[model samples]
Target: MHIHFIAIGGAVMHNLAISLAEQGHQVSGSDDQIVEPSKARLKKANLLPEQVGWFPEKITEDIDAVILGMHADINNPELVEAQRLGIRIYSFPEFIHEFCVNKTRVVIAGTYGKTTIMSMVMHVLKTLDRAFDYVIGAQLEGFDSLVKLTATSKIILIEGDEYYASPVDHRSKFHLFDPNISLISGVEWNDSRTNISKEDYVNLFETFIETIVPKGTLIYNKESTILREIVEQTFDCKINRHGYKMPEYSINKGVTYLHDGDYRIPLQVFGKFNLSNIAGAYTLCEWLGVKRDDFYKAIASFKSSIRYLEFVASVNGSVVYQDFLFSPYKLRTSIHAVKEQFPCQGLVTIMELNPYDVINENFLPQYASSMDESDHAVVLVNKESIKDKNIVLDDLEQDIKRVFKHKDFVFLTDLDALEGYLESFKSLGFNLLFMVSPKHNTMNIVSFADKFFKNF
Candidate 1:
């Protein structure tokens, strides 16, 4: 098969191109710009386009398929040429579904925790020598790529995103998976960039529930009132439903252990929210025929990357962590978990306020008291991003201070100033917590932490 990728510079897009290329498909790709990791990976696979920009000449009718990336605009030259030539164009999700049509698709969907839950399931399955395909949002440790496809794998675990599938496909990405087994870790109204209303956001999950195949299994977070209500209202007698909450666990000396009756399974991860994700992952794996004892043994070594409140480094006994937290409920849950994990340490949290949060009038109010658990809360604001979004930063600092209601709240627009502020905390012995999304163009928290604590 021959595949040409439009806007293949994306993290996931490039990986998919490489995976297909490795599978002996003729793969070629183009992008306006390509950065490290993706660029290097593509070059390594000999799939990197000689030139950076799209070329209509490359989109010949002979090409088997054109995988359109979210980064590509609807009028992208290659996409336009493909349309004119009547060549099939598919979004990543659409292509994934078509490629794995015969396999049992297991989708993990929610506003948050889905990535971690999906990672957990993949890790456990891989540990037990199970064969499966998967597509995840973020890169995970021990995984070669974010996307994988196989000819013989009987199951495909997908990290179902509620966001649009592609620039041309406005439908929710999860809507395309049509999973045989699905899990909704939790649902919350979020992503000001999406402009999806609270009601619409809830409706997205409801629609996702409807996408499950007949007699499929749905594992959901019973603790979430909104998700529970949706499950009840969307009840399908043919669909088997299994609800889960935070399972029995004990934290000793900042380490979390999952309790399976008399046996204690120690984990490399921690936090109440993570515990709940574990329960969700455990339920899904058990349903997939993994024995309870084997599941516990394999999951004992599971360590999520910093994308989910994982530790990065320790500086003079002060720990530094990066997490995927943005929504109000997630903000509160993550902040409380970190505080609870290290009750003795002074917590200094730095959260990035993206352009969406800066521009949306309702976004800031949702974060009220969300950072109350932190000893010092700092908001990282990119002045350039605000300017690019055509938003005035008038009174944003004051607005955040007033909304958080924290006595020690601050917002920094300059990276140097933010770094200096963090340096000041060295003497204060405060543990650093970065609650920001990696998708946003900002300083690499992991790289910065490693460099900052190089001596330590």
Candidate 2:
């Protein structure tokens, strides 16, 4: 098969193009701009375009399929050329669906915990030597690429994102999978560039429920009240619905252990929220016929990576932690977890107010009181981040103040100032937690944080 990709420089797109090349397909692609990792990986596979930017001349009649990427718009030159030739075009999700048309599709869906839960299921299945295909949103510890495909595997696990599948396809990516086995880790009202309302957001999942293959299994988070209610209201006897809550556990010396009767299994992950994700993953594993004992052993080796409570450094008794927390609930859970995990250390938290919702002044109030668990908290807001959204610092501060209402809470705009403030904390002997998203395009957080830890 001959496949051509548009905007092939994307992290996942490059991997998919490489996968196709390695699968013995003749692959070629073009992108307006290509960066490190993606650029290097594409070149290594000899799939890199000799020149950047789309060329209508490359879209000849012989190409089998053209894969469109999120980076390409509806009027993209390559996309337009492919359509002119009447070639089959596949959005990222569409390609996956076509590849696994006969396989049992297992999609992990939610506004939260989807990636981690999907990672858990993939890790355990791989440990059990199960042959399966997978598509995840993030780079994990053991996975070679965010996507995998095979001719013989009967199962394909995907992180079902609710975002737009492509510039031309407004349908939610999860809506494209039509999974035989599905898990909705949790659901929360969220805003998107489309300005989708709360009702519209919830309705997407309701639609997702109806798309499950007949007699399919849905394992959901019982602890999330909104998600639980959504599942109950839909009550379908045709599809099996199982509710999973947090697993019973105890923490010892800052390490979390999931208790399985007489055995206390230590884990590389911490917190009650992660335990809840494990429960959701466990239920999925059970549905797949993995033995209970093997599940435990596999989960024991699972270590979460950066932005999921990844320990950065320990300067004296004070440690630094980082996470990719985007939602209010996730931020609160992480803040509380850090405090609980290191009760003896003075907890200080640093967070970036730069997500789409955070930059929108109207939604800023949703985070009120969320970070009160931290003894001293800093909220970093980039003026440039909110500029495009028309959000001002004063209004954002007021919204944050309304929610946090903390005596020691402080807000800063300059990245250098924020780093200086953190550096001043070195002598305070407190555990510093970075409850931030990696979306801060201008700053390299790891390198910046390294300076503080080394100075201490």
lDDT of each: 0.85, 0.83
Minimum summed lDDT over a 10-residue window in model 2 is located at 436-445
Model 1 steric clash pairs: none
Off by over 4 Å in 2: 191-194, 355-359, 383-403, 426-429, 441-443, 448-456
lDDT of 1 by residue, 1-456 (tens): 899999899999998998898889999889999999998898889888899897899988789999999999988988989999999999999999999999999999987788889888998999999999999888888998999998989999999988889999999999998899999998766566457678888889899999999999999999988899899879754699999989888777777778878988898888888899899999999999999999999999998763778788886777888887667777777788878887887887888876677777877788899898889888889786776676545677778788889888888887888777655555335577888865774867876676445443
TM-score of each: 0.90, 0.91
Clashes of each: 0, 5
- Measured by TM-score, how close is model 2 to the native structure? 0.91
User: Could you report the Cα RMSD, in angstroms, for every candidate shown?
Assistant: 2.9, 2.6
Tell me the lDDT of model 2 at 386: 69
In model 2, what is the error at residue 417, expressed in angstroms?
2.3
